[model samples]
Target: MESQESHRIVVTLAQKARDGADAQQLADFIVSSWQTIEASLSPIIGQRSVATLYKRSFYLASREHPWLMDMHEGMQTTVNLAALKAALLERTSAEIAAGAGAALQMFYEALTNLIGASLTERLMRSVWADLFPVPTQENSA
Candidate 1:
């Protein structure tokens, strides 16, 4: 439950962190960004409960991996700006939705590059394993 101002701070911190800025400055920026995104998405998700999900998905993901977090923040900002333009250009909801999906796909690509494809895949696998605790193929056999 952070305020919009706090979220902006997180975003600023993330940006600064990417640029090799001071740790304190970067920390403040990230806090602000986290707060802002939370505030903006709160209404759209139709409940405060969604905040936890977003925090885990977006904030936590970024925080745990500094490089990924920086890339994601930058990609999200670009994607959001593009989304605004797409919404304006498209007359139909379908077109707008399509544009948004495209933007998301592009963001995923950016994320992949940020973490490096191999590392990103490994990170995802690890996360999945942490959640599911599935046995390996060799163990199963």
Candidate 2:
């Protein structure tokens, strides 16, 4: 069974990925997030594997969000983030959030299944850290 921590991690990543941007800016956020994830995982799993997994995640997500198929179809390369961003630009903020979040959640779950929770969490945490700052502990009064 999936842990709540895993679900939380996926949700947090998707929320933070938007970085408080409006709909017009969401494409940038999504592309940037995907690039970071690709970079982080490619080294460990091989670029081909990362691309494959990325596509698979989207494919699975598209079953529920059929609009995602348009985005996936626009991808010329295995992981054509430019195409994804373009497709995202055509969508509204709510659609972007829902579809992107679903895809991201699927990707995280797939990674956890393939590599085990421990390694997936470590790698994903690295991606999260690279994209967002971690609050530091302040001195107690």
Highest lDDT: which candidate?
A: 2
Q: List the residue pairs that clash in candidate 2.
A: none
Write the residue-wise lDDT of candidate 1 on 1-141 in tens digits: 332222332333233334555433333333343344345444544334333343234434444333323223433222232323332243233322222223223322333455556653454443323322343454333
How well does each candidate superpose onto the true structure, as a TM-score? 0.30, 0.77
**Candidate 2 ranges with C-alpha deviation above 4 Å:** 1-6, 9-20, 73-77, 130-141
Per-residue lDDT over 9-83 for candidate 2, one digit per residue giving the tens place of the 0 to 100 score: 445544644456566676676788889988888878888788877887789889988988865554433688877
lDDT score, candidate 2, position 26: 65
Model 1: which ten-residue window has the lowest total lDDT? 95-104
Q: After superposition, how far is residue 64 of candidate 2 from its true place, in Å?
A: 1.7
Candidate 2 vs. true structure, TM-score: 0.77
The C-alpha lDDT values of all candidates are 0.35, 0.72
Model 1: per-residue Cα lDDT at residue 28: 38
